[model samples]
Target: MTKNISPPEALIYAMVTVSAADRAITTDELNRIGSIVRELPPFRAYTDDWLADAAQDCGKLLRKPHGVENVLDLVKATLTPELYETAYVLCAEVAASDLAVHHEEEKFLALLASNLEMDDLVCAALRRAARARHHQL
Candidate 1:
């Protein structure tokens, strides 16, 4: 049976997926995810263990066969079409948080775009914005 996830949970999965894309979840990426949850309007209602719990659930899903595909499918189903770009942007934010987008992360980003049916130009713009935001001083 397919599992159902809330929009907020879907968003967290998106971030978590990107963070784990490189096979390691860095401190910087975790911190970025926390800040995004704490500051984003969609996550305003999420508090305390909500983030951790959602991340853990996502991790579980990631461990199963075809886990990544399951996650992308779940996320695509949970969120509305308008939120697809936001989901992509959130993933980009996490991927770029550590200041380096690994090869796996790049592949995941492309997959995310394709799964969500996001426009190429829009994905490019969001990716550029993520890189710019994380640019070092």
Candidate 2:
């Protein structure tokens, strides 16, 4: 098992995983992650420097055996049940920030939803919100 991580760190891992799901993390995605960390209420106590560190730590952990599963388990363990939806929404935001959700990103979201025991209807609503927020005319 990975070391016990803070809730903020767990959320960061979720975003990073979603960002990297497509194997090509885009500039838009990176900006979205940064913005989420800087603006989100959950991350209010988290510093900008810690954002980079947490993302790096998540990446290194992901290089290990069964990394994705391990990270998901860590996130599920670290966050309170109440924050599961928050975690999912944050990830969905990142995945949709570039105005496109790739196949890999969709897969990651499904895995995250399963790991967090999120309701399918809630996930659908969150995904729709993310898409609507990121949509441009």
Candidate 3:
């Protein structure tokens, strides 16, 4: 049976996965993530307290072992196909933000796509976009 999940929760899960991909979350990355989160339509009307709460929740989840899969599952179960695709693209953007995509990050991204049941073609497109973004940096 499928589990129920919320869009806001799914987004937060995606962000948390990206943040933990590199094994260490840098301040710059965290700030960038915060900026991205603030700009998300779902969070458009969100106050500072709401953002903080989400970030804290993400942090708490990250502290647990092997939580990425759980997060990915939650996101996949909640998001519609279009939203999942968009989230994958956003994840690529976040992964490429540091000007380099670490091996672990790439693997994490692949795992995320797999968990979300995204097609290989779509994943490839997202990966290409991420590479393009990295080159532009």
Best by lDDT: 2
Off by over 4 Å in 1: none
What digit string (tens of lDDT, one per residue) describes model 2 on residues 89-123?
99999999999999999999999999999999999
* Quality of model 1 by C-alpha lDDT: 0.93
- List runs of model 3 lying over 4 Å from the truth: 1-5, 134-137
TM-score of each: 0.98, 0.98, 0.82
Query: Could you tell which candidate, 2 or 3, scores higher by TM-score?
Result: 2
Candidate 3 has a TM-score of 0.82
Using lDDT, rank the candidates from best to worst.
2, 1, 3
Candidate models: Cα lDDT each: 0.93, 0.94, 0.73
Among all windows of 10 consecutive residues in model 2, the one with the lowest summed lDDT is 39-48
Q: Pull out the clashing pairs in model 3.
A: none
Report the Cα RMSD per candidate.
Answer: 0.8, 0.7, 2.8
